[model samples]
Target chain A: MNETLNFSEHRMGKAIVLTLQGRFDAAIALPVKNRIRSLAEDGSRRIVVDLGKVSFVDSSGLGALVAALRYVSKDGGDVRLANMTVKIQQVFTLIRLDKVFKVYPDLESAVDSFEEY
Target chain B: MPGRQLEYSARFGPNLDNLILGADLVARFREETKVNIKTGDQIELAVGEALSNAINHAQAVGDDAIGLTMTVEDGMLTITVDDNGIGFLPDEVPQPNFKEHPSHGYGVFIIYEVMDSVSYDSQNGINTLTMKKRLEE
Candidate 1:
């Protein structure tokens, strides 16, 4: 039941892995959107958001990720999601976002996806 | 527990920080009632969406607070979120175009998807969003 939202970033080859810890709700959506904007500005075209530790995600949280995707797509970049908890995946599926974003089971697979591009 | 009913209620200020408290309240209700994990997840998500909508749309009037009520009775769970902010037409909200990959406007849709029955009513300056789910036998 981690309710605090926090994130850390690191580079993996051509992709940046942003691991989010805690609930991804409206409380932190703006900061996350800004973070993604900064990453895109820094020439990181490929991003993988690891949600292994994310206990929850509301529409605002999902909106931030979609906003990130749109922002990067303008620069011919992409954002992928990885390690979604069962609950998180349920929401994605319910909203049909599972079709829009490439989702992976773990960090290794998510980073590896960038190699195909 | 066929005829027994458990209930919880709380009022939170119109602040994003209160989202955590809203979530904790749901979790507490789920645990106390021994709700199944799958159903609990659905309840949590639906309630979270409802609360987020209320909080985000809240007008910064003095002493504005969102009211949340949850109850489990007769194999059903119901959640009602009330706010004093100006309300909008729920039917007028267009569903997100999945093909276009829209970012916003999924909040109301998700609530409808997870809950068995959803209704919205605004009366006497109070807007209420009520959601319900049937429990497995």
Candidate 2:
């Protein structure tokens, strides 16, 4: 299995939208986490992580997202999740992370949510 | 033990690269068994979690290999991951406080969610985790 993780980013108003592709597991979680950390350090606080292309996520991935959430929330900003597969969503629910992050069915809605504040 | 049985197993180095290779082997196993995508994905996730724990948490003194065994029988698939490392009490694992945004400790829980049954054993510097799931008809 080719286990490479790559992400694409774009700006939706003030929110930095990142679309992550490939497995979100221990082997690749650190790089993804570092990217999010860099974004936060660059003053991009409102972030939306799109998981539509992500096929799987383990604890490490979950932890990375949680870390991203914490980083962005430090200054009254937030990190939101979008387009999680049912299986991936189940993991979030199992770990009770579903309650911790704002989840939307699509990226547009997620970006719209930030505009509401 | 209820239906026709097929077994495939292998051992590999206890590292992330080997874990990825093992996952490929598992994908082939699923294809050979005609497992549906959803159920196969579950198996992949469960076994992946088990192997991740073995690779990340189970540390050996020297170069100990992680062992994997998979058996499909009677509409059920079973996988075992063994590591020669220090073991911990499964029951003592704390539920992660996602609200607190903790960065570790969710591997085993994901296994429990994806597998039908999961159990662990440890003795003589070896920790073994076994997980089972019912395959789709």
Worst 10 contiguous positions by lDDT, candidate 2 chain A: A1-10
- Can you write out model 2's per-residue Cα lDDT over B94-122, one digit (the tens) per residue? 77556665878887777777789988999
After superposition, candidate 2 runs with Cα above 4 Å error: B61-64, B98-101
Across A1-117, the per-residue lDDT of candidate 1 in tens digits comes to 446899999999779999999999989999999899899998988999999999889889999999999999899999999999888988888888978899999999999999987
State each model's CA lDDT, in order. Answer: 0.88, 0.81
Q: Find the candidate with the highest TM-score and give its number.
A: 1
Alpha-carbon TM-score of each model against the true structure? 0.95, 0.89
| Top-scoring candidate (lDDT) | 1
lDDT by residue (B1-137, candidate 1, tens digit) is 57778898888888888888888888888778887898888888888888888888756243446889998788787889999888878899898888887788898988888889999999988888889898876
The TM-score that candidate 2 achieves is 0.89
Deviation from native of the Cα of residue B130 in model 1, angstroms = 1.2
Return the TM-score for chain B, candidate 1: 0.94
